[model samples]
Target chain A: MWAFDTIFVMEGMKMGEFKFISTLASVKASEVILDALFVIAIGVIVVFIALILLTAIFWLFGKFMQQGQKTSVFEEKGVNNDTSSEPHILPEIPVAEAGISEEVVAVISAAVAAMSADGKRYTVRRVRRVVNRPVWAAAGIAESTRPF
Target chain B: MNSLLQAIVDIWNESGFVRLFTLGTGNNLWERIASGGIGNLIMLGIACILLYLAIKKQFEPLLLLPIAFGMLLVNLPLGEVMKSQFNTLVPLTEQEYANYLKGIFDQSYPVFEMNGQYYWQHFETGGLLWYLYQGVKFGIYPPLIFLGIGAMTDFGPLIANPKSFLLGAAAQLGIFATFFGAAALGLTGISDLTFSSQEAASIAIIGGADGPTAIWLTSKLAPHLLGPIAVAAYSYMALVPIIQPPIMRALTTKKERSVVMQQLRPVSKTEKIMFPIFVTLIVVLLLPSAAPLVGMLMLGNLFRESGVVERISKTAQNELMNIITIFIGVTVGATANAATFLQPKTILIIILGLIAFSVGTAGGVLFGKLMYFFTGGKVNPLIGSAGVSAVPMAARVSQKVGQQENPANFLLMHAMGPNVAGVIGSAVAAGVLLTLFQ
Candidate 1:
């Protein structure tokens, strides 16, 4: 444990006052231990306190932002709900007929789910293969766009 | 023929080779050693090894290569690449006039009258490296580097999960713990091993795991220890992937490591823009001593997030960053010339640095376990080790280690929160140390 008296003595001292006990040779072993402990306590406590304050501030900020986002989402949903009169229909594509594996369809659906905001689930309506570009061009595009 | 022979001898005597081998007109082995030739040879050897590491091993080559080259340049005998410039007042006399006429002194040397006495102000120019080193010495380059880092860094992760800030703060345990370790080592009472509190603080900052912060704090607190401390700090940073994993794995079980954290909520554009500004105001208001490093970093981040200063942000992260990196690297390396570097204390500093890094990693992971326990294992303890700020490297290490346990786990973004938070934490820690010591 750190000695309170040492910290009190240090508190009253101004800058450069610690120069006297800067080196261990000038002070007793117990005093050096106490000084070092005091430093450790203060340093760790201050860092934690500062970061905790930041955490609290940002947590509140995050909550506020989330609330704003929720409000906007609700407002957008209200308008959409009021305007839509027709029944929504999904043209379910048969995986075997479309020449796509069940796993591939599931993967595509999962990707769509991942990208969806508000966690709204949507059924996969169809799957189409558009042969618009050569394989080399596709490879080049993939190569160029790959994340670092 | 005799005159020509004498001229050839004069040229030989004036050459760096003569200075390398002989001392005060003596050419004995003892004289050569006494003349600092042997020390320079050792330094050159060390520089070559560093060069090999930078080139072949690819250990932080961008900075290490320049640093090694600077070391090589400064250690060359009679190179005077780091020598200081000085002006001397020489009394104008008949002999002095004769010497000047004979070109012994530069003909351009200015002559002036001082106290009714005529004098020549003979200016001796400083070394090239000495001028460049002033950027590092005066605390200029580190903050500039931080500006570039700020521009590149995405604090969105940190902002999205603010609790990661605690892990960041926890990672700084290494620094203060090392401070205690350093001070405790002083209790050994060995004459060569004793370190002052200032020296301990400088050495302890290596635990911050941020090179710029380490250099900034060391330059301010213990300029003499800058060489070894910078070398140790960067070396340890490069070793993060290797040094961190063992500690990370040891601290957390496979189950804890595999615990996949939920993806962070998407931060709004307004929130992203406000993050840096809010951080700057709070951090600077609390610790004004951190203003230079933290303020510049936040400014750079604002440049990036604001999306208005695209050109300036690009320059900060790319071109300006490169130039300052070269200058800071070479000049800081140049400081490691024979006298200051080849000491027992340097070894202790390196050892203490490793301890600081290890302790910091352990501290972050342990704190993460506490979070995991409190949150009922929702927080993967593996991401805690990323709290030591080595940027994406430490975070990537967390991801890699976690993936080893469970391939589906993606902790990179989650780990990034603490990773960047570690940067802020270290800067704040550096400020606290500076306030206490400086």
Candidate 2:
């Protein structure tokens, strides 16, 4: 029985040795260089492939998102276009033959008087409409090109 | 007077000072060196030097301080903070059992019979560090650290410019190159200098220039080399500003460095939210082994971008990150006990780590030059060096170098694209290595 047990233990030890050799330990000096090269080529290639795939996916995703933003911006412009297409209604301000109306001048002077601080009397200045980009378009540009 | 003198003599005999000066008897020089106190003294000195670097030089001090203190704690004689636990079987007689029933013997250990004999199973308690080390041993802490990093990072720049992903991939050249270099070192026929494939993989990851990723991969591939590898990774990462510039200058022309690229397009909030989800799906599908690190990172990023979990994101970034950093730092440092770390292999690892960092930086810059050529001088090659995933530090180096050439140039946001992309790239490379080696 003791002899049988000793043989059993020896077999177990031999099996363990075999397992160890089959693993990393089995790579001989000659094969180490080849193995390292194999790992480098495969590792670099795999990493590049993975990242490149990500680049393609995200690039497409960016395009899709940009298209969506453009569509939204156009929709906003459509709303502004609808408002602009409506009939223009000029405000009721009586116009003189050449100069400004007296009623408008009186209203402007009263407005200036309402804005006076320290209770000092102030003169009415001329008012003019400045031509600029529409509010919606300017807002869209600012939203799209906001810097970091 | 006689009793006092006797007490003093007894105390002196029991003191660690006595143990420190004692020489160990062994059959061989290596064995004697390990068993004696001199090795521990040398380790203590090394620990002190690291402490000086961490404190005075501010070299990644948040983690380095705890790691150095842990090393100091472990090397002190009689401080069994990291001792291993084991169970022993003691053969017990029937009479001893009866005495135990009568409370004559201690009953803390249970008595049991195996075969024809009765034995007591005595369990020994392990040290404190041994318990805390389970997080690293089970590969838990690094992923959690990734989670915090994800929460803190903004992937907007990367989303705006996807080509940066290629630069990220290119920077990993150092990792593979060093793998071959380390394995080829074995051809020199120096027995101690040779490395197995796993050791080579672990050392090569130092080129990734990511501390948590390096730790995560090392713990899996080569746990024994964790101490030196972690130290080398963090040291090189801290030295990124110094190491990357010259390589960037050497690899690119003055005009290429001066190229001021157009600003990156604004990334929408919805795109930012979808990015983490899609990246997680694709990366995990490609390499399931990387799921832990990459998944946790995405989850943390999701927590930030989803904007619904502000509380949880804050906790992951602040409290949870700080706690894990402490646990990982100290435990990883404790692994550098003298017997394992005092080998020639460690010095080699340190040198190879520097080479890996330099090569990785050069690869990124070279790839940047390639992009500059292909794009008809639209791309600034300096930003390519930021692809090594040292994060904002690498990006800042790009910005600083570009400013030196053209003060009007701002590459911080642009370089951030590749900087963050490098994080994902290294994690992917880590997954590939784990697949091959693990």
Candidate 3:
């Protein structure tokens, strides 16, 4: 901006009549224009420095974007199964025509009721449970009958 | 009096309906209707190309057909039908020009005091495109139209592969590149041209290959260029399959195109459900200007992924997307009125836009090739070019070109990774441009 206004000043134009710059700011003389240019340069340099820093941050984030996510399928599966201790049931409603017996239902319900020690009838609900226990322990535990 | 009535009758007499049934035998309706002025002749030629692409080529027919038809109508010069100025009436000489021929001035539109004659001191008026331009100018309809866009987008793929955000950033190379080029080109003493640096940057961002992002950016930077930039962006997006394949083929050797990539891992619904919320919060808080686009887009994705919002999501994807697509397309097409669109600069705009797309494609693919070299052949080189947000279109072009090279290679799934990434990359670019330029 100062360089431009100086060229005009060299040509004998009045200080206030600097018409070439964007209609954003008025210039009083070459020195004022220099001051404005200095401020603008500092502002721009600060912005560029900020952007370069942001880029480095984003790059660091990108480095971790896919880290630690590359374990083999088989090994992960073995560890996952070993850490859970419940026979997961599908969320679908039990079909009566599929030979689900009333005795079995009653026994399971009473076992759960006895364990809970509550007054309400026991019912199966869909819940994602991840319990840590030995596989045999999960398989052997009977849902005992309980009541409040 | 009969002559006056005859004139009205004469207007319809030449109507093909009259001659068709009565005179029959010889060719009638189709022949006369085909007679076109020079403006229409050009429009028809362009329309024919679009028709061929839509019907025979099966390229984006839904949008191309209507847009082509609208262009045909606008250029036909059928008197004052698609009127440029709404107040353009043959100014009624109210009380007989008996007051000594007042004064005359070329004072364009609605001026109550023109030359000193107050014709409008007794009358009222409006600008034609002004009413229409409002929907384009005030950033109203496009964002509202975005509600539909937000409803339609599937964020699952993007969320499943968040690293693709890099590809999105890569795709915006054309926007910044074109902006610098346009700044150099500058108006440079073109009087009627009134482009702010931001305005020029807005128009240049259309190169990013994403329409909504282009619109979002344009609305912020240069509202005047909205109509042209939008029409161009969507038109080119529709043309992606045709426009990109040849370039892809030209750039890569047959063996390079055939490089196979490993299949993507199974994406879980749990991951998908969490994706939109995380992306929205991070991107919006970080770059508020990008919220209108990234926010709405993520919202749409959340609706689709949350599973519980299935009903609302379904309506957004289907009804909202479809309705807004039509409104946005037509309103944009209508903006190509003759006066604004007919200038020499428009051709330059088209030329520069194509360059922008090509550069963006090349930049992404080149970056991909670099990664491929570094990874020692794990990454397929063809997927990089699909890093354009034209969505499935750019990806499909990459797939087609890859198939041509090896005939056995299936690069579609791999290409999708970059294709979705390109969308995010362009948004990030938009955010950067907004932060700096605003």
Best by TM-score: 1
Please list the C-alpha lDDT of all candidates, in the order they appear: 0.86, 0.86, 0.59
Mind giving the per-residue lDDT tens digits that candidate 1 earns over B185-254? 8667675687877889999999999999999999998999988898899888889999999999888888
Best by DockQ: 1
Off by over 4 Å in 1: A1-8, A11-26, A82-148, B1-14, B18-35, B92-113, B118-120
What does DockQ come to for candidate 1? Answer: 0.34
What are the per-residue Cα lDDT tens digits for candidate 2 across B1-438?
999999999999887766666555577776566566766777788899989999999999988888888888888777888888889998877798778768788768888878977789988888889888989999999999999999999999999999999999999999999988887886676767878767888999999999999999999989999999999998999899999999999988899999989878999999999999999999999889889999999999999999988879989999999999999999999998877887889999999999999999999999999999999999999989999999889999999999999887889999999999999999998998888777
Model 2: per-residue Cα lDDT at residue B209: 93
Segments in model 2 whose C-alpha atoms lie over 4 Å from true places: A1-30, A87-148, B23-31, B91-111, B116-120
Model 2 C-alpha lDDT per residue in residues A27-109, reported as the tens digit of each score: 45555555556678778888998899999999999999999999999999999899987887867653333345677767877
Instruction: Go through the candidates in order and give each one's DockQ.
Output: 0.34, 0.27, 0.04
First chain TM-score for all predictions = 0.55, 0.39, 0.30
Pairs of residues clashing in candidate 3: A110-A145, A111-A144, A111-A145, A113-A146, A114-A145, A114-A146, B86-B128, B168-B425, B169-B425
Q: Comparing chain B with the reference, what is the TM-score for each candidate? A: 0.91, 0.94, 0.75
Query: Would you estimate the TM-scores of all the predictions?
Result: 0.84, 0.83, 0.62
Residue A31 lDDT, candidate 3, scale 0-100 = 38
Worst 10 residues of 3 chain B by lDDT: B17-26
User: Considering lDDT, where higher is better, how would the candidates rank from best to worst?
Assistant: 1, 2, 3
Decide which is better by lDDT, 1 or 3.
1
